[model samples]
Target: MGSPPWAADPAPASRLPATNLLTIEYPGYIRDTSDSLDRALVSLSPVAGPRVDAASSAYALAHLTSLLERGGRVVECRLPSGSGVPDAMDLYKHPILGDVTPSDHVVVRVHRQVWKRMVNGQEERRKHYRIEVLGASSTCIRFRRMADYAFRPEMPAHASEHPTMKLHKILEEMDVAAMHAHRFMPEQEDYYDGQGAQRRSNLAMIPPPFFNRQELPFYYGYRQNPTSSLQTVTFASTSKRSRRTARKGDADLLDAGNDHAEVTRYLNRARWRNMAPVAVKFTEDGPVPTEPDAMLAQMALSERQLAYLERLKKHLSERPVWSRLSLLNQFSVADARALVQTKELFALVAYTFADGPWRDALVRFGYDPRQDMASRFFQRIHLRGKAPRAPTTRGAFKAEYGQASASGKAAPAVGDAQARPATHLFDGQHSTFSTSTFQLCDITAPVLLPLIHAEGPSDLRSAPDITTGWYSMSAWEAIRSSVSKSFHALLSEAGPHKTSEEAIESSEGSGAGDSSEEDE
Candidate 1:
C-alpha cells in the first residue's frame, strides 16, 4: 500500500531548452527565441478575469506569478535573480504593439517554508503539455489560468476609483447579461494619441486582478515559460494590494466612514505634512473584515440567510406544501417531520399529473434555449444511473425512450419499457457502487436517433450490430464467376507456343533475305 522510491523522481531536466541563459549576439542582444516562445505560451492560457480566479486558491499558493504583455518581455522593476533592470532597449517595440523589447523582471517572494502547503497533493483533473528542459533545468512552470484577454468595463458609477475593484464589484453583482456582454479584443490603445494630434498613453485597461509592482517587472521572463505561463481560467487573482496607489484623493473617498478613518486622518492631517511615515497594515482581506477582531474568527450566520432557510424549512413542513413535494426531498421530509412534529402533514406526494410541475412550468413560461441546452439537464439523466422517481425535462425523455441498453458498470438502469419511471425517488436507496454506475449498451434504438450518453468508461457500447452474414456468401459466388471468366480470357491471349511461333517466323524471314543476297 505504500509508494515506491522509483515513483518519486523530482527532476524536470528534460523540460528546459538550455540549462543557462547565455548572453548571445542576436537581434541587438535579441531574446528572439524567448520573445517568440512567450507569445506562443500565453496564447493558450484561460486566465482572463477582472482580478483573479478565486477557486484556484489551492494551486496559486504553490507557484511564482507574473504577467505577460503582448510583446515578449518582463516589465517588473526587479527579478528573482535580483536583476535591478533589464539590459535591452530595442526589445520594447513590437510590430503589433510596435516592438516592446523585453526590459525587466517581476519578483514576488513567499517564504519557501509555506510553499508546500499551497500546491502539494492536488489531484490534476485536466490535460496540459509538459515542457521538457535540457540541462541543470530546475525550472518547473505550468500555465496558471490564462488572464490576458481584453475586457471593456461596463463603467459603473465608480469605475474610475480603481479598475480591478470596479470589476470586483461588477462580478459580485454578476448577472447573465453582464457575462454575456463580455468581449475579448486583442488591441490595446495606440502608442501615440491620434498620430501626435493628442497626447500618447501607455496605460491599458488591464482586466481585474492587476499584478504587483514586482510582478510586472518579471512579466516578460515568465511569458516565455512554456510549462506554466499560459493564461488560463486556473490562474487566480492576486491576494494583496501592491504598493502602487490608483489615485491620491480616491482612497479618501472610498474609505469615507469606517475603521480606516484613522489611517485616512493620518493621511489628511498636519502631522503627515510636518513628518509622518503613516503606518500601514496590510491584510489578505481588504481594509476591513466582517469580524470585530476580539475573537480570532466568528461562525455567526447572517440573520437574513438563517431566517430564510429556517422559515422555508418550516413552511415546507406544513400540510399542503409538504404533500406537494416528492420523495427526493425526504431528508428534509424527515427533518420537517421532526421540526413541526407531523408525519401526516409532510407525507411525500405519491403520484401526480406531471412528474415535475415546476420544471414544466419553467419550460411553459419560456426558458432560454441556451439554458435549456445546459449540461445540467444531461447530467440529471446520466448522473442518476438508474431512473429518478419523478421524471422531468428533455434528459429524462432522452434517457428513457431514447437510450438502447444500460451498459456501464456505473450507468443508470436500462430496464425494459414495463418498469415504471422512477424520477421521484431518492438517490441513495439505489446507489451502491456494485450497482452504482448506470451504463447502457448493446441495444438498437429508433434508427437515426442520437444514442444516450455513456455515464462512464464501462458504459461504452457499440452501435446496433448489423451482421453481413448470408450476403457475404452470395457476393463471394459473384466474385468467383468473374474471376473464372478472366482466367479463360488470359489463357486465350497466351495461345499455345506463342513465343516459339514468333521466333520461327523471324528465322524464316532472315533465311530468305540471306538466299537473295547470295544470288545477287
Candidate 2:
C-alpha cells in the first residue's frame, strides 16, 4: 500500500505574528484516522482570529502568556466524533485526507500494530494506527518532586534501631510544658457571635506591653481641596511604614492630577474601639471565691456593674421569680466570664432554688411561694415518661392531660418532669429559657426531680402523693422551712454582723420581717 498522506513533508509555518503563536503539547496518542486527525487540529485552533480585533487579541495573548509563566500543564482535549464539518468552513468539506495542515514546526510520529479479534465466532486480523505529536524539548517543561527534610534523618540507622526516640522525647516535654503553663496563664476574654456561641479571641497574640503604650494618630491632606484646614486621620494603621505605603498611591495620583478625589470624612474611632474590656481576677485557688466575706469586702463594683445591678433589681421588683437564662437573655450578656459576674451580683439580692417549682430560677430574698398557690408560678403537674407531646392549642393540652388521668397510669418522677416543656410555661415571655434551661438538667436522674406547672385537671390537688400529681400543702411548708434556713445561713456567712446580738439588731433595724409581708 502507498505511504499515508501524513508521511508527506509538513507545510510552512503560518505567517501570523511570532508573538501571537501558542505551542500546545499533545502528549496523548490519537487514532490515525482522517476524522480523528481533523478533530484534533480543530480543537487546538488558536482562540484569536481574523474576527477578533487587535485589542481583544492582545488581551487573549497576555492571558495565555500568564498561564504559561505560571507553570500551566497540558490538559487532555475532548472532541466530538463522527460529526460533519462546520458551515463556516469553506475548505474541502468531504473528509479531506491530510488536508488539515499543522505548522511545520510541529513534529509528528506514527506507530502501527497488528491484532486479532473475534467476529462471528471467527478469528479476524485487524491493523491499528496511532499518531503522537512530539513537542520540542526546549518548549516541554517537567516538574521535579520537592524534597521534604522533616521526614529525612540526619544519621542513617538499621531497621532494629529507634531513630525517632529523641524527637519523641523532645515533643513530649514540649506538650507537658504547654499544659503546665495553662494553669498560670490568666483567663482570656471570650467573644460571642450573633447566635451567642462562644469563640476564642486572637488578642492574646499581642504583647502585654503593646497595650500599655500610647499610639499617635496619623494625619494626611488631600490635594483637591488644599486650602481646607481639616486633616484626615488614619485609624487602621498607626506605624510609619504602613502610613507611607498607604499614601504612596495617593501621592502619585495627586501629583499626576489624573484621579484626584475629595475625602468625605475620616474613619470613626467609635466603630473600631467598640469592644469594652472586662476585668478578670485570677487566684491560686480558682476564679470563684471560696469565702463569701472576702468576696463581699474585696470585690468593689464599677459604675457599669452598679448600673447593671440596679437594672437587675428593677426586674426583680416587677417579678419575684426569674430563670437564669431569662435574665441573661434580657441583659444580652452571653459571655461566660460576664455571666459569672452577673451571678455574683445576683447572689447579693436573691438566691437560687436547688429543687422545687423554682428549679434553675432565682427568687427575690423576701418573696415567699406558700402564699401564692392561686398564681400559676406555684402550680405543677406530673406526667409519666418523656414529656408529653407538645399540644398546639389549649383544647389539645386539656385533652392530652385529661386522657392520661383517665387511663390510670403511674405518675412520672421529677427526673421525667424536667424533660423539655412542650408549651411555654412562662407565657412565652422568656423564649430562650423554654428551650435552653431545662435541657441542662439530668432527665434520667432518679434522686433529683423537676417541678413543672401545666394547666391540667382541677382535682389534681386531691392526689394523695406529691409525686403522683401536684405538691401538697405540707410539702410546701417543708420546702419553705428548708429554704428559710439556707437563706439565713448564707446571710450569716456574708453579712458583717457576726455576733448574735448584732445579727438580731441588724435584722430588726432593716425590718426584714415587714419586708417579707409587703413582698407577699
**Best by the lDDT measure:** 2
* TM-score between model 2 and native: 0.22
Q: Please provide, for model 1 over 287-404, each residue's C-alpha lDDT reduced to its tens digit, 9 standing for 90 to 100.
A: 3121122221122445643543355445433411112222222333224233233222211111111122111111111112122312112111112122233233355334323343
Q: Model 1 Cα RMSD, Å? A: 38.9
lDDT, candidate 2, 1-520, per-residue tens: 9998987978655343333234444433457697555555453333321221222324434644565677554321222224533322211111211111124454455888999989999999999998665543234322121211112122222223223333343344677764444322244343554466845332312122112222233346535444333334433322334244445434433322332343223333323221211111111122321122333434567887777767778877877666654554454312323555545676655554444444446666555443354333322222111222335434532322222333345753222222223322222121211231222121211211222232344423543332221444544343333222222332434433333334434545555431111011
The count of backbone overlaps in candidate 1 is: 88
**Ten residues in a row with the worst lDDT in model 2?**
90-99
- Give the TM-score (vs. native) of candidate 1: 0.12
Model 2 regions more than 4 Å off: 1-298, 333-337, 374-520
Question: Relative to the unseen true structure, what is the C-alpha lDDT of residue 394 in candidate 2, on a scale of 0 to 100?
Answer: 46
Best by TM-score: 2
Report how far off residue 299 is in candidate 2 (Å): 3.2
